[model samples]
Target: MKPYIFSILFLLITSISVAQTKEVLLKKSFKVDENTILNLDLDNANVHIIESKDDKIHFDYQIIFYNYSRRKINDLLDDTSINTSKNQNQIFLKVKNSLYLGIDIKYKPNFDYKNFNNPINDVYKEYLKKYYKTYRKSENLYKTKDSLIEEINFSIGRDMDNYIKKEIDNFPLKKPLKTDKKIEKNFIIEVPKYVQLKIKALESDIKCDYDILTEFKMDSFKGIFKFKRIDGKNNQITSSNGILETYGIKNSRIQLRDMYKVNIGSISNSKLKLEKTKTKIGEIRKNVSINDSNSKLYLYNFGKNFTKFNLTGDYSEINLYNVKDTNFSMDISGYNTALNMNGTKTSFGASKEKELTKILQKKKKENSPFLGNIEVLLKNGIINIK
Candidate 1:
């Protein structure tokens, strides 16, 4: 993998501007091999990739430009960018955040209103006291054209309630007057420990305690991988609201595409493919296969190459707890769906068991050999795996 392009530099040229707090220092040094294949694509900012025994590949950056301006810091020293590509053991980087501000400030709301359907005040005092009591009982009637139409409805209802109480007493509740424009970039990368990281982020925040990778591709948009530990054995993570706190990758083969709920903690000897994701889960250590119409997945631990769990979703849901005598194999079908499994040497197969929803298995002591060949294909939704 080779591709590097960066025109617009910083790091010892010591002649900067931006009319305010300004500083830039981006040290670089690279000389690969020993399993080097680093790739990073960043956005917003806050990343730190560590692991160095001095094998090479160091980058110490420090950029600050608050409220920039000076022709946008000289058009970021003239058209900013940092894109790269390298091969024969790969190394590609792309960074962007060219401290800008050439001149742009457009705000709205010059204030002007006339009662947008009773702008508060108990909705104009309960509909103006029943509309002036039905206009004084329909002008009671005093001849002379009903007393000149009740003096023109009491002078247009007291001048439309004083122009709606002067537009609710001049609306404009503070704030807003902020000429926005700010930029800041902070990163410290030092590679060479166990190389193999393919990360892509947007509104960034990443930290990796590298362990010499083999393969890891993470695509996060609204990023956050705090205190991450990499152990790539063909690991793939595709995220939106990114936040993966890896404990220490091992026994791998995990492919996850998450959007909503599924905050895993530990995984081992993995084998998973979670797509269109969100397994209403908090944590699961392995063994999974899911496909969703929307999203929902959760298989409470069975670590060490977790015993099989295959799920297919529609309007999904599967919540089960550590059943007593756990011997797994549940092939569920879907409709109005619901699978609520409990415990006690749970055995089933033969169609419908109803001992008042069985729950009488108590002398138990055995912890997860992790077996559950549970196969569920849902359309509507319910599979009580007990």
Candidate 2:
């Protein structure tokens, strides 16, 4: 078999496979009311659930957490939450139906910490060691050195202030504590107060709408095949009878081709009004004024060269209002070729020169050597002997 033939066959197979195995990604957010129990299975890392609530809101949650990685739950928790003290690390409670006014359960890297090595203490001790070393060295130098040492001490003090400020800025600031204390006499100020509670309740079945979003990359091939229109209404199609149609040929390349026929049936009180605008190629516009109350449009594309072919079709249906102010036009061209062998070499030639000439004459006449060459090719082959 020829290389081009194999290439075309492989393209058809790949296109069919791709069409069969295509998937879509969807992402959405939903709001749940307060006091709702959420049962989540965290077996899949791609799936997650989060909860939030106001003062009057309460919620019970049952989640089966799974760690696909080799790391333990404690390690994951430690990574997710910040630990300020060397000896103290916040522990996550695990039980069925642990109720809370608000609960957020998604993967948290910093909070997943449970191990022999305490990162918080290790980091603080390193900082303290550096601070003490610098301070002690500077103090000793101030006592031993001359007047230049005073300037050095001043610089050291400024450096220490800046370092402390930066460290303080790095620390996470906690929210201020709220309190209510009534004073006996002198000017008592009144303030509103609300309390939130976290409670534990039994796990119950709840309807959960799960939405998954994912993206996959796969290798595939693509090809263009011809499609035929089975039915039409209110308009006449030039290629209505079963015929091979091609559109737009540039540099010996067929831009578009339709292997199927186009058929347009009768329409009642049908009118086709087209308005055209000048473009780089030519005038282009919208086609309106064809309205059929009871009619259907049938279309199909046929694949050749291979027994079975995959087709991907996309169509845009435009509904136009007010035909008096509408514009539309169409430009189509193509090449039809037949292969012939003269001696040992094979040549390709077109088979529709006179037909194309008649069609072109109906639209517009353009006298060009390029078209004349095409006409000659249609009569003979790509090559001819005198």
Candidate 3:
């Protein structure tokens, strides 16, 4: 057989051997009160956590596998395990061991059956009928099936219609395959509104929303976290090579470090610690204190009644925008820094000046007596206030 024909045969055989399947690995619930804490450790999974009115904590862990044989799936099921234990008011859930399943490849052949059923085929059939109507007693040109196929090919080759010609030209003669692959594990966890979460995860995504939890803490390595409208007193998140995003935070303390990207929105009375991260804040309300290092921070806007803003960082880029409407006083102290306020640029520590300190005040109201105070101490960086 030809090499291409052999390749097609092998692909069809392989495709026929494997099938897509899903299996529930674990389904369990824990009885807890308002003060319960959930300590979870997982890898290679997506966790969706939401608040529930019920006092019990419910979680479902499952696996979705593709292009794998039943035997292989059974082997994987035997090898995977999740460990759980209860410790006082805290429930511990951890992944003991799991084998890495090979990536799944979804193959699609280039040949489309619907394209072969074109209107041109119907026209050719009509022509065949009309031609045979007149030559019924005479020697027919399409005497055998092979001769009919040849006539169809000839007609398609000689067609002048652009649509038909383009279709024929674009259609692949060889049944080449297109492939895509994805591997996913998912967990849906539901807990009480007042419960706390302590999670340590790797290469996983987590999403939570709309709960007045006591605390939300996670130490993740290489993953994405998204929190929407979550209210808490002490919510701390730390990640390395990860993305952290929050839509709303209220009266919370958040510590984030070593993140690739960070986006925080509409926070009030919060304490934030950032290190080696690229951060963006949508709005600051009330008061906020930030301590950062070797990062870039961008503040988009401020709330009307915000009274305090303090930032301390080194080797960073700090940008504050749209603060001209607020009455505030800024005390900046840093060395080897570039300060740009209202397009006025100043450099520090590059000349004879050492440990320079500059004070700036913006008063949009009469007799406001500095409604806000902005303090910044940074080294070897750029600060922009406008």
Candidate 4:
């Protein structure tokens, strides 16, 4: 027999009788243009959207409220809902939740609204004022603004709890009202095909496989992206730390920027704006072309050959592979560069070179241009074009 088994059963029965139920939080539709820009920004919610043949965007949202003790005036947690606003061709949606330290306050104790001068509250405010006057004067003596706000909130919460407990005879004590940590909503949305999409999510995965005649943009601060395919338009994706996958891609203006890693399958259309904060190529499928800023691009077996690459910024590497009758061109300028290509013609020069009359009475020969070129410019970083 386990200790406190009867007590545990009693507690479970009590909780089951009083646990808050889930309900539909928000349900609304707006007038949308034919080619719309659907923007969704959330703190922490898994967003799942599939393109249907419908004309208007359909949203179905639900939330689970916890830590709410049933009291008088049953409208307790009804004010917390998502906001939807619209402009000309853009529709913005947002849900503020506890993911980013958002507080969920419960009001079970009788509010002292009639009695305005609360002794407990006055004592807490007095202490807060004294501390503010002593330690929080300067504007530029801290590390970050966010840290300052967090510190002030901590001070207020501690002081209030201590003061209220001391005056418990006069002031009623309050139990902390907190939502469950599993507070993300299973958000669902459906929209038309010809629309641009933008989302800002935290700790969620974004999977976009829509291939229509429109542009797509997503700035995921802490989430990852799964890009399957794209049509004949532009696509921009940015992430903090996530893996990206794009398989069937065609003539599109694509920009894949990340602070972590990217994986691609087949990409065409010599318009790739790639920027990676790390100094390594995560993965590439085949014949991928990119106008890159910085990263080590390791070229293995050209999956679908004829990959063109143009590079800029610091400490980049290019590992090249040779095929039959495949001519290549490289325009590299930097302080230190490493090119490791066996059985390949190599050339290098400083952009600040002299003329014939000033130096050797002859100009440096230019190599015949190829379909794929590696043009580089650097100041004090290694340009590894292999």
Best by TM-score: 3
Question: Candidate 4 has which clashing residue pairs, if any?
Answer: none
Question: Each candidate: what lDDT?
Answer: 0.51, 0.21, 0.66, 0.49
Tens-digit lDDT track of model 4 for 52-121: 5667787777654454333311243343447898987899998654443222222122334445575544
Against the true structure, candidate 3 has what lDDT? Answer: 0.66
Count of steric clashes across candidates, in order? 27, 29, 0, 0
Q: TM-scores, in order shown?
A: 0.31, 0.12, 0.70, 0.52
What ranking emerges by lDDT with the best candidate at the front? 3, 1, 4, 2
The residue-level lDDT of candidate 2 at 122 comes to 54
Which candidate leads the pack in lDDT?
3
* Global local distance difference test of model 4: 0.49
RMSD (Å) per prediction: 22.8, 35.3, 19.6, 17.7
TM-score of 3: 0.70
Instruction: Please tell me which model should have the higher lDDT, number 1 or number 2.
Output: 1
Candidate 4 RMSD to the real structure:
17.7
Error of 3 at 19 (Å): 4.2
